[model samples]
Target: MTSNPPLPVRPTRTAQPGFPWQHFSMRFSSTPRGARLARRLAGERLDAWGIPYGSDAHHTLTLIVAELSANAVSHGRVPGRDFRLCLSAEGTTLRVEVTDTRGEKVPTLVEPSDALDGDGGRGLLLVAALTDRWGWYPCADGPGKTVWAVLEVGTT
Candidate 1:
């Protein structure tokens, strides 16, 4: 009879009650299609996390991802590097972060466009208006940056 290897032991931890922060991260090519995918995936993930379909939190978070992902693809795209999207829900607040490989390029928020002209710069502006708070930070690993936004799940 062959001896089996020792069974893996599972560590016991005190279970914490109440709200848990769930994290989801994904990478996509820096392209228009990739940006759209990021937004759709975010909504799906939020639904799976029990945030409720068509809730205020769900729509706001989805829009935030759409804008950030668009900026990443359009302004922050590097030659071969991909962009990353990370979403996490902590307590009643949901945080969305989109990171791109270009560090030299940064996005700014501005007043909403009053022009009837097409192809205007208004992505970040919309993000600022929708999100409770939003900002960008240099990537800890260097050579990239992360733009993040936070919104209250139920509170406007």
Candidate 2:
């Protein structure tokens, strides 16, 4: 029987000093299936952190993850490269970041007139509506960028 090769491991950075935090990170293929997995895993992590499944924070964060992950797969895909999802919680803030290997395709908030009347161009809008803050930065290590969203979760 033939054996499959082990997947490549990706580096994950943790939080700096002064604040206690909980973190989870993983990389997924730049495909629709990977995006779906990102959303599911984020929901599971939030539940493990004591955020109830249906709470405002849990629901909001999950939605943000879904939208961001979908965008990464659709717009930021690089052949044979994967996208990354990172979740970090410190105090009342939950940060969600999705990184993809397409630095030049930096996302911008859609202007009212530019948005299509249909289903397209609404991802960032939902993100903006639900999260406390959202933005993106070009990755310093290589040819990619990380888009991040912050949501405020109340202590249980």
Model 1 C-alpha RMSD to native: 6.7
lDDT of 2 by residue, 78-110 (tens): 989999999998877889999999999989888
TM-score (C-alpha, index-matched) for candidate 1: 0.81
Q: Best TM-score goes to which candidate?
A: 2
Measured on C-alpha atoms, candidate 2 has an lDDT of 0.86
Q: What's the C-alpha lDDT at position 13 in model 1?
A: 22
Q: Write the per-residue lDDT of candidate 1 for residues 74-107, one digit (tens) a residue.
A: 8999979999999998777788999998888877
**Model 2 lDDT, residue 121, Cα:** 89
Error of 2 at 21 (Å): 1.1
